[model samples]
Target: MISGRICIGLCFIALAMQVSSAMAEVFTYPALRSSQASDPEQSLLTSTQPMAVIYGSADIGAFVPVIEAFQQDNPFIGVEYHQLQTLEMYDITQSQRANGEPAADLIISSSMDLQMKLANDGYATSYQSSETDALPHWARWRNEAFAVTQEPAVIAYNREFFRENELEPPRTREDFIRLLVNHDELLSEKVTTYDIERSGVGFLFLARDERFFPGIWDFVRILGQAKVKLYSNTSPMLEKIASGQVVLGYNLLGSYAETFTQRNPNLGVILPDDFIVVYSRIAIIPRGARNPDLGGRFLDFMLSIKGQSVLQNEGNFNPVRADVPPSTFSSLIFDRYGERVRSFPVGPGLLVYLDQAKRQRFLRRWQDALLNRR
Candidate 1:
């Protein structure tokens, strides 16, 4: 006879397999092709000049203009930008480093934990320049990993739905829970949040939420009781909010949400009035980088006012530089809500939950709360 524990373990394995299959179906990494290749997915800007490869989790379309602007100043060098999922970037960099081959000149990822792990484990090399030196103390770690953006975890909702119903959108976590409870019938299955287990960045946000907010578990429980939808990525949730399939999405990346809301006037973003948890996409240079000089140069460029301007104006990413003007969507938010913004710092503390046993235990507790399971 199969024991209950064994059955549960098998069920989890099956669920993981299904999630992997689903992710594979929905996400495909574009293959690297020659500079002359016609596929826009292949390169941010095709060039035959000396190349500097950048591995990042950012969408190519959003980052292309930054690279194009970078090349305008450094015309002798070309960029080959390869987009990967956050975890994929960490794994590939580690594997390549172990094999004595570096994968890219620079790496950019939303998973601050994984990026910190790489630097902590000696997988990244240190570099310092005027731009790096001028960074806020919290944004750079030992000159090895530097935050390049100031995006926050926020709530996104359907603006038209709220306006038409004469209901005020949630401005804080408590309000969100109250709204869900008070309008249970209207909100049932009409809310969504990250599936933490499947999304590295999502898990990071949840871990931080648990630490920062004492009522986080209770909030998760309310979300579960509301039958909140779960997704591994933010885009689908934003899409659902835009289409009114889901009335609201919780803990979404503010940068992406702001960008999406630009083209989708009906979509709205709200930074919690109680507090805002800001996350940054960290940049690092691999220890085994084939072109370390170019990597350093690019890293410096990314931290420069010009590079940050492109990130803010073109990439729709919030700038990490304090000198950057509050002209972009997120910067304007920062200006208004700076006091509430809790920027996740670059340090060893982020590694706490990454412990295999700790991660599993956290997920188990989260499942119990959010899944209503024993």
Candidate 2:
């Protein structure tokens, strides 16, 4: 019910990894009027029709082609999408399930840790098939959560600014730190990154950085002292950088940034060479879903070559299927960093940072370093 866009991306899963031989079942979601839902923010696109409710953090536009194809195949099954912030998606879905109410049929998010938490907590169901089994080790976990896209955390800058100002964008974190320290006066208030407090994926990137880099606190403190800009989401952050409002952006999802950069000759996307934080967008089928049978079919289709091609070409997303050729973005990423693409593996290890006490303490430290520094 929060103020957010809607993108219907859905999947259904079974208790066992084996596929249920029964045909996909259609639920009775007779079309309800939009007025029936009390919350104005929850836009029920076509109610009362059998729908596979999907909650996710991706842009509504990015999901259209995939959803349309699914609907074309399963015309009776409509899609209801609620585009929530990853944190909001987690909290609301967990709360609804805890109350024994119906929630989303599918949950897809870039906040992988949060998705893992839900899977670890038994909020999701599981399904296995040749398609699911085909996934690489790093992409599927516990038969519950599956990564659908291969992307990375990257640094993007205004290409025109770099050319005119003769600035070399950082190729490594060390180079980044040097740039910040050496050009703080000129770059002050001109650098932007995620506001971790408002962004689940942003916090995930920062938390992982802290674990991997011993001196991240010093670099983060410099960001605060330099009065770097903070934003809650990718669209605005990327737009600002492309528009020349910000000279640099950190921890951006490389796939989206690459698309933006392609459209804007003035933008650049760089995966740090010292080490790269490769990530994937994850999808899961929640337990107690209204139309889980259809959800499973949709999920299977999502992982199929046909679906992945739509993702790679139409949606402009990185498809996780190994056979999909690398987009210009991923091709450049590998050309630049080669063997150093360190994947954030899909597993319970992600749960380490989601512990409530640990998460609060981590965020407090991050806040002090990024927002409270003088």
Best by lDDT: 1
- lDDT tens digits, residue span 1-374, model 2: 21132332333422122223212122222222223456655545535556777776777656667776676667666676666667667776666676777867888888888899889889889878877887888889888999887778899998888888788999877788889889888788889888887787788888878877788888788888788899888889888988989989888887678767656878888878777777778888899887777668778878888887777676567778777776776676666676877777899998886788998998888878886555
* lDDT of all predictions: 0.80, 0.76
Runs in model 2 lying further than 4 Å from the true structure: 1-49, 334-336, 371-374
Kindly report which residue stretches of model 1 are placed more than 4 angstroms away from their true locations once superposed: 1-48, 328-331
lDDT of 1 by residue, 163-190 (tens): 9888999988889889988988888899
Clashing pairs for model 1 are none
Best by TM-score: 1
